[model samples]
Target: MENKKIILIVLATLIIGAGLGWLIKPTEDKTNEISENHSLESLDHQEIWTCSMHPQIRQSEPGACPICGMELIPLKKEDLGADPDSYQMSENAMKLANITSEIVGMGNASKELRLNGKIQVDERNAYSQSTHIPGRVESLSINFTGEKVSRGQTLAMVYSPELVTAQEELLQAASIKESQPELFEAAKEKLKNWKIGNTQIDRILANGKAIQRFPIGADVNGIVTEKMVELGDYVERGMPIYEISDLSKVWVLFDLYESELAWVKEGSKISYTVNSLPGETFEGTISFIDPIINSQTRVASARVEVNNKDGRLKPEMFVSGIIKNDNTDNDTQELVIPKSAVLWTGKRSVVYIKETVDGRSSFKLREIVLGPGLGDSYVVEEGLNSGEEIVTNGTFTVDAAVQLSGRPSMMSPREKETQKTNKFISVTLSEKEKQQFEPILSDYLEFKDALVADDFSSAKKLVIILDKRVKMLKTSELKEESAKIWGTFQKELIKSTQSMISSNDLQEMRNNFDELSETTIGMVNSFKLTSKELFVLHCPMANSNKGAFWLSESSDVKNPYYGSAMLTCGEVKSTLK
Candidate 1:
């Protein structure tokens, strides 16, 4: 009985110890589960949120993009695996934007160069009818301009006292012809000096009387453009009496701009039409191109000699012409792209290349070298492959997205230091020219500020002032290189300012500002501003997604393109010293 009690006590103690150990182990497992939950909560707090349109805008928590005011979405870890130089968008977003791309390849490209010109009289075929004898006009046969006259036709009758005296001498000499034969020949020679024909001399000798009045004959068949003599008008020898031109051949002088100088050559063929002659077409070959380009007009004349025997083409008639020129030499093919695919920033030509990002569509902005502009397209010289895909339509949208993401774009670059090194020869201006151009810069800043504030009326008023200031630029003192730059800027400034002033809508004015800023920036860079410290600023949301740049007196960020929606959205791109 004693042994049984000991064994029961030991068994009871063992059972109690085992049950307590089980309860303690459950508490430890619960603690471990709580710690794991805490770690997961910490990871959730570290998530990053960003705007889809503006991926550059990053926040620790959910918020809106600072630049575009777009709602921020959570960034996934898988998105980080995409290319750093490219950007990604959803299929729905791509469809909504209507973005399209095409594969560039080599092909033969030709451009039709349209030119305006006028028909002019062939200078070589023109002549001036003049008299050889000094006389007084007795009667006028050709009364007005545009009267056609034939060769050897008598145009007017003149009375000459000298001729009558000479005839009298001849008559006297004829009386002593047997003894003074030399005298008779001498009198005949004097009449010949006055352009009197042999027949008229014979008639004078036959009649044996002095003829006082002489008839002046036309030298060539032509229509009279000017009559220098009137009835009873005294004229001197060698004086031009009538200005005449033959319409057998005519010259078509076409105005060629500096940009078109390359395509037009001496032997190029051209087909033209005139508004006066409906449903009629004329063809001619270029005979000559003016060696000198006009300073004011910035154009040269291309001459085409055309046979106008039919008289269908008249002088001073306005005409239009088309010149079909091949875009290459040696007939080799080249890569070409539509003009819409390019984003010209004055300093650079950029295109957005399509890329695959995380198994989806994306785009990367790339700089390219352009060869020739073939009307609606351009030939690619460098910076692209033969089979590369490029954005052909809605390129502006892609560029805008690239800018919003703070990547290299038409207006913005990832590394601005690279752009600071300019390859183009710098245009230098004198101190006087720079001083005179300071007011233009001031007026431009004012216009830019108005657009930034989204004040259309103020912007229009300021653009008017800006236009006058740009027009007032003293281009007279500029050197040849500087004058070329000035000419280019003047054309662009007039176009932009006029467009801005005529537009009442804020968006259009902003669009005009983009072009205006491009010209202004180029001017500033080429001339090297001195009076003020100009800062180049950019706004990615302007011009319907195409980014734009503006000049500012200060480095402070003021969103001129976005206005009150996002007041301070841009950064200083460069400081012009």
Candidate 2:
């Protein structure tokens, strides 16, 4: 009876325990099931982490960016839909590079063209003082050049036999006034014919004798610029006695070249300063522009009339002037950009335009057509509009960054320059010059191959040999522009080679290889130096972000810019066959 009672007690305890276990176990199991379902999805891309600001950093797990110290974001977050052709740079990157931007808008358009000029006598204000009656000069009132004279001022005294005779006739006629009244009037008129004023004639009659010497008076107020007569000098009627120039006004004449003719016009304002009088600025208006250009000088005179009552401005004084275009016609708006913002490639003018892409600031390369240059700025005729942002400062830095990222850039070979890559220049070369050039091309290819193989010593040695061969080339046989073109590229090529030779570092050697490669590519474009068809391969990842071009004997790309790190980082951009 005791054994059976114990068994019944144990069974009752077991029943209660089973019911508690069921209730408690379900809560843990349900929680664990939910976790297992999400575990696979969580591990999808969360295992590895990187910084959003710097994509170069990588870690096994989440932390901070080693370079920038920004909080590490999941690698999956970095797939921000960045454009392939645009350059993606974080705000931190821009700040580090000292990059700045500005909004493009139209404002008052103008340019200040600095010019050189000279002060001159106003043609209308210059005069020639002349003697009216023929005579021999007895005395001179104006003795030297630049002597001030006024209208009706006696300039010189001259003795005239004809005037003496006319005076005697007038006196004789006056003696018999009642007998011959017409004769006396005719004698007075004869003296008047010689420009003898009525006042002077009356003075002669008052003296009651024929005056031996007559005085010549100035006709206008001026300074005598040229003395045409000396003491006791003989003079004829209407003979110039002195050259006089009015000092109250002057003219400033500026030489306008053929290229600068359109910028200046009649009535344009000019602010000028004379070399003789420093720290003093003067203003004037353009009174005239020569209608015809001087054939010998290839220039036209732009005249500015200035008041010279103070007599400070002297003739032939050098003057420097500035002309600022007014752009007063506000009806049309012109787009102008800073000269620093433009990347002027021979074929295309480009700028880096800043825009928002994927909720982040991005800079894209854009080609623009440029108009006339406005001193420190350029006019944009096409490819841009108002209200857009552009990289104004550190534009080359941005382009370099974009270029290193494999985007188009100023140095990047495009379809325009590449289309004519196969068009070899028609420059004829002598057989001896061609023979000397062959080994140079061969050595260049070897130098490139050494860089591709990361052989530093071989590269240096081969470049030295290449430099010698380049120096040996003689261009005396070539003529005209062809010679100039060859000289330019050849000199550049030799310089790059010398740089590579002096560099003890492989990276530096590779850096200089960029210049060498471009020159070689240019040479290949202009000449078919080898029997084998040469290939112009471009490595977008070369030159630390600036794309580079290299010549390869084969179609396969062996990038010399990156060496073994990215031997196959490029492709054939163009070919020379």
Candidate 3:
């Protein structure tokens, strides 16, 4: 009977325990579920922020940018899936960056070419102060260069053995003048040949001894530019003692570049300002144009004569001149764009065209053909239409956004298929010049293969060889317009290769290789130098996903940018035959 009573007690205890556990389970699980729901909701609501100046920076919360210390802004979803070719900027970001845009229109095309030059001496009025007799310079009346001397002014004193002998002959002839009048006349004629005046000869005859030192006089009133002989320095007869230039008239020689050669004529009117003299404007007509272009400076001179009786304009003084080169072509309307809006390379002008779609402003980089420069503006020859708006101020800011977003920027030479107008270099290559690029093309292909194989050393050597071949390409036979284009392309090509040569790492060289490929593609298209089949391959994942091209002798894909990691990450973009 006691055992049965204990069993009943145990069963009752078990039943009570089970009932208590069931009662607490629902409440506990419900509380935990609520906590998890709250946590997930808070995490989902978090926003992403970035800096306008530094777009690469991304943060989960609002804060200052780590790189540039700029205030972070919320990355708007408005441009999330917008046009790939355009850079969309929020209104708030534009205001914070101090960016401004302007609407452009067609106007009368007038270009004012501004040239930098300096005041120079007129060659016509310049004269050499030369010695009539061989002598050693004893003393100089005009001690230094730029000292003024009047006509017949005693420039220097020279000890001349020839003049002393001539004077001695005069003295000897004067002693026997009564017996030999002809000899006396001949001796006086000899002194006159040495530019000796009658008074000086008479004084010498009065002294009855040869004058050891004779005075050299100036033939023209001018400033001495150069003193060729110093004290005790021997000079030859008819040798220049001083280079003197007349200040009554001067030449304002403006530096004329190869691109500006066509616009400048022999009689173009120019209005200029001297840097030394403020608030004064001078005007003159271009009197002469240099026949030969200077090899080193690659510029010619346009001479403009100016009357300077007041001696205001001095030699070596910097001057800014403007020439109004009116465009006579009435068929093409002039679309003037702000100079600040344009980002220029050697042969290209880039502008950001702004278009507002659905209240979101998008900027697209457009390469334009620049016409004549109008002081602070440029005439748009191509790549733009009237009534278009562009980024006038803070253009670089817009370009930066476009560049980071993987669109065409000033540095990236991206070619868009849908582009309305293409950049026209207006260039051609001769047969000999085309043949000259064979070794260049051969080396370039090897360089591309080296990068594809991830061989940095081989690429360095091949690029160096390619650079030499490019530099040695004969461009002298190119016509004026063609030469200008060739020079621009050549400089950019060399610059790209030189960057690779100086790179410290393989990745850096590959980055420069894209630029090299761009310059090569441009040259090939314009020059049409290919004789055999070649392929232009493009890697969409190259240049930080902005896309890059490389020349290949074969149509097979071999990615130079990604190398062994993504060897075949390219497509045959085009073929050249």
Candidate 4:
């Protein structure tokens, strides 16, 4: 009986062990298979290394960048195949580059006013020194411009015939004062009319002599700004002999731009600096605001009164000034960012926000409501918060990454597509004529590449070349639909290129070029062309040799290859190799 029980226990134990093994065996196999697949994927998508400062420098293995000499950082495996112009930094790379971002917040709304004006003589203190008598200038005491003078100081000697006659009449009247007392009084009054002082007249009367010439004295103390007559020069009646300006008080004129006009008002205090006096600063009070705005610059003039007792400030001196606006009335203080931080897109503005996961850095896009731009910064109207970090420098790179990810950026993808469609509809290109159309498309891509590299000279050259090529293509053979589409595309491309040319913003030119290239490529893909037709009509002058061509028959039309086979001449091929 004991032997039988022991056998049964042993058999049961064996059965239990077998069942456990069956259940656990598949789970281990599945885990191993998943691990193997993950390893294979990682091998295919190996990380690349690059420099932050020199984005163009890329290496398959990790090390320092030769150009920048900064430690190379591993690039995200997923972003390895992104556009060359588009920059994408991995978490480690962002930290190494010291790149950070923050959320945007609303801040107080205040106006920033930029005023421009020149230095001018104070109108109240400016005086024109002139001789009252009709006479000839005998000698000028003040000979040069900017010579200082004092009140009652002699500026010139004038020999006036009328004054000589009046003085002689006074002497004659004095001799016969008892017989013609009224005549003596009239003669004294005539001397006073010629601006002869009472002391000089009394001396002349006491000496019984008639003074032939009188000294022209300065009426107000100032500097000689205009010397009208030289020594021994003939002077006309009531003609100005000299122009004088009192430097004790002066006016500083500022030209305020249209946007800054609202913040600057009469009586605002301003601080200024002159290039001549680098370290010295002066303060003034706003006294006047011009009602008219300049037609060309759209700026209004603002006048400020300055005290220049030291005579350091001179008229026509270039001055740079700042006005501190009182934000007391603006009850709300909102988040503020540097003007350079906001990227404008005609209708909207965008800012890049830095995101952190357990202190690991990443970048994200944020649309912002932008207020008027201050001299160096901007007040955030909305879509931001206080203490949030943002990408102040290298924002263009961040924006490019956002665009590559197919995210809604400052400009929507839908809008871009619509614009491209409209442009394609306006161009005049034949459906079957691939030679002329292929070159235009190829030229656009080259222009885009040049722009991305910030090579303005190359971009301009490409633009000119494209224009010439378009001109050479015969419009007679073009189909109505094709011509209209080509026309629209050309118009838009021309407009964008022209804008870049005018502004001279290399970055904007580059961005526009990218848009144009993408739009052209998309249109080509949508239109469709077969592999055989594409090879026959391919762009011969293409830099990358990746352009497709259309065939004479509609039935042969197919999708152009994109992605891995971007340069392949085929019907949407998955890979080129």
Number of the top-ranking candidate, with TM-score as the measure:
1
Find the 10 residues in a row with the least total lDDT in model 3.
415-424
Candidate 3: residue 146 Cα off by (Å): 5.2
Error of 1 at 218 (Å): 1.0
Candidate 2 lDDT, tens digit per residue, 1-577?
Answer: 9999999999999999999988777577788888987896675545566654345556777875543345776554433345545667778888999999888888656768788889999999999988998989989988899889999998888899999999999999988879989999999999999888899789888999988888888899988899988887788999998999997999999989887777888999989999999899988888899999999989999999888999999998999999987443656678889989999888689999998766667888888998777888887889989998999999999988766654566776233323323333555555654665678789988988998899988888898999988887767766566677778778888899888888988999988887787777667656546557888777645655446778888997677877766566666866677
Best by lDDT: 1
TM-score, one value per model: 0.60, 0.53, 0.51, 0.53
> Model 2, stretches more than 4 Å misplaced?
1-84, 89-93, 111-120, 160-191, 198-210, 249-290, 293-325, 356-362, 372-375, 400-407, 416-577
Q: After superposition, how far is residue 377 of candidate 3 from its true place, in Å?
A: 3.9
- Residue-wise C-alpha lDDT for candidate 3, range 1-577, written one tens digit per residue: 9999999999999999999988866786799999999998776566778766445557888987553345788876665445556788889999998899999998777667889999988888889889987889988888789898899999889999889888988999999999999999999999999889999999999988989998898999888998888888899989998999998888888999987887788888999999888999988899899999999999999999888999988888999999987665666678898899999888888899899877888888898898877668888889988889999999999998788765668887464422111353635667776776677777888998999899999888888888887788777767777777778778988999899999988999998887788777777777786788888887765776567778888887878898877676666867977
Higher-lDDT candidate of 1 and 4: 1
- Candidate 1 per-residue C-alpha lDDT over 176-213 given as tens digits, one digit per residue, 9 for 90 to 100: 98999999899899999999989999999899899988
Runs in model 3 with CA error above 4 Å?
Answer: 1-99, 112-115, 134-148, 153-192, 196-215, 224-236, 259-263, 320-324, 327-332, 339-353, 356-376, 393-577
Off by over 4 Å in 4: 1-99, 108-120, 172-177, 203-209, 274-288, 294-304, 314-318, 326-330, 352-368, 382-392, 402-412, 416-577
What local lDDT does model 1 show for residue 193?
Answer: 94
Report, for every candidate in turn, its global Cα lDDT versus the true structure.
Answer: 0.83, 0.80, 0.83, 0.66
- Quick one: RMSD of model 2? 10.6
